[model samples]
Target: MTQPSRRSSQADPAPSPAKLARVRTVAQDAMRGARWWTLLDLERILRADTEFWRDLWAPSLAIAAHKVGLRNARSRLDEAIDAGFHQTDLFEPELSAAFGADPDWQRVIERARANVPVPALRLTAWPEPGPAAPLRLDRAEAHRVPQLLPRLPRPGEGAWETAKTLLGWTAGLWRHANARINAGDALDVLEQVANGARYSCVEYSIVLAQGLNALRVPARRVWLRRGDYHDGIGQGHAVAEAWIDDLDQWVLLDGQHGAYWADEHGKPLSLPELQARGHPARPVHVGARELMKDPALWAAYFAHASVSGIAWEPKGFVPVFQDGQVLATERLVRDSADAYPRLSDLAIGVTAIGGAPAVELKPVHPYAVAGSWNGETITVQGRQRFARVLDREPGEHRAALAAVTPYGPLASRELRWTAS
Candidate 1:
């Protein structure tokens, strides 16, 4: 491996008019997009490439602007730091220098420094045996899927877009009412809904999950409750999540309200992500319909979002709970850092050139995954959990892994590293 050379910013001359405009344009877009990393990188670029050290510190400038009471200058920097920003970023020297002087900025930094990072697998040893069987659930009957095909979007429509369309359709099925019917599954709910039956949030989740499963998109019902659930707080919300093959992550869908929460970049969020309290999710509705237009109102619902469990059926294996509830609480979590796995949990490592130059893939969670490393395909499922090694050259390499989900194969999670 070779090291790239570096140039000193002090030796660079002043920027021309064109370069100034380019820098400003980048700064403007970074702020408008609410992508915190881009704004940070812009600060580094300005400090490294030209004499304008703090000129492009857009977020920092906004924070300072807020303190000065500038007209229409409400700094979302604090909110950005509170949500979506990582603790690893709190230590950036440029960031420290930019906001270190202000006492108010220092408090925000301190709070963000305490934020939890997204959980990823860090294997200390090779994977052991998983459950005797993968968690299987009752899928929408194939014969009944044809009934839903005509109502869905085109076959090749994007995963996220298709999901949103289905959410809209399911939500508009019937008016929400707190009535319990002796329905067996989502299909039963749908049939009853057509005959003038109004159901609760539970039915909304079931129908959405079934709808997605019918379309070959991996989906499951999730129950959210407060910590005082057992004490009869009577606060809970049922929603469904679908594994988007393009994003490689599960996104929450609320058919009850015809709503889903997304970040500023329009990326749909999972229940766990919303529980992380990192990013302020914006409420989005399907089609031209408007719902939950207020951010505060949306955040209030998810503020106490404690997941009770996932809704799935175990084929050969008997679950602790018979109500088809697979606990997502502390009972199921191995790591205290995160409540649950947001994406497919995987452990990947590479051997040195002297050690035969290979990459080892380990799928940790019980969910089945199909992966490819350096032109090799690997599949892990059920008790068949074992490290699969792929031969690769002693250079930069990349791998793509996706869960062979209940809905189908989701988007692949990409991994890249240099093998020396």
Candidate 2:
């Protein structure tokens, strides 16, 4: 007993160099991404409620649905949902549908819908779009975006996935031909392509852009030119870009190649972003067969030497042949306001229910509606369509709805009402 009592307290071992290095790298990455400055951000930081923690842990939460066979796939997905990877739409359609009825999966979707975070909103109000020019939203008959939308294959969820699916469908419309024939509008182009007319990249972009517009996603054709475009030797290439409300950024879609570009994090990169980064892009192909066989060939096509000038066509329906009607020059636009002047020109309908404190919100354009009522944040993503009914306590209710545009949320005109 005397010998045992002589033992001294033990000290903990120091962390190994490898462990210290990994920790430093992770911390550095987190700090670089936080970029917090505002007073609200400070409070969130103090409360440890910033999305930084969620963002940091997102990669580890990624579920490889492909690794598991069809038999075990459902259980694996259930496990993933229980672990907090709520992005079920990211999964393959077959995989998700095969086991969507599971209680855990259904619960996760319900929870995600209930806890939808508020989008960034403008304080102006609904329908009173500011000084910006209005977006020429496609008439249902004008582009046939409605008819074509359901016909198109939407394998995954979200705006980005739909754009990629449309790109693939557009690229497969016809074989590539250098012929300069007029493809007319997107519908006309489809009709002609079906009748054995091979078109160029211009037709591909035209169809892709129009297809996205039908889905309430703003998009435009991008005309890429070589530095010596004036020589008229090599006019340039044509591609498309769509404004994804989910990512809140313009993502390049090459319908001609059935591909799109992304950064290290799999975030789709706009054409200008690719140019700024010396076109170090990772191409994501959507089609069963790639338009460009060699992956390395894509970088060369988008290189500064190959594509020096970038121009965008005006929104709405424009004859593919009349593309040159709009001026073409060297311009690198990343700002959503500049890229899409009419983004805020959204069509919204607010209707009151008889003698009730509730109002029905109908947004013509697709995407969710986020806003506040008496300082309480609310975001509504309807299943039937982009419409929702909001109810508040009986009193004078001051509510504002924000349209979630690719350029960010713009506030709508404030609605004032008294409920008894």
TM-score of each: 0.47, 0.47
List the pairs of residues colliding in candidate 2: 125-412, 125-413, 126-412, 126-413
* lDDT (Cα atoms) of all candidates against the true structure: 0.56, 0.52
Off by over 4 Å in 2: 1-151, 154-156, 293-337, 340-420
Q: lDDT (0-100) at residue 415 of candidate 1? A: 62
Best by lDDT: 1
| Residue 418 shift from truth in candidate 2, angstroms | 18
Q: Which candidate has the highest TM-score of all?
A: 1
What RMSD does each model have against the real structure? 24.9, 26.4
Give the range of the ten consecutive residues with the poorest summed lDDT in model 2.
Answer: 1-10
Model 2 TM-score (2 dp): 0.47
> How do the residues 157-257 of candidate 2 rate in per-residue lDDT, one tens digit apiece?
66667777788777777778987557366776777777898888888877787777766577777766543334444446778787675665667888888
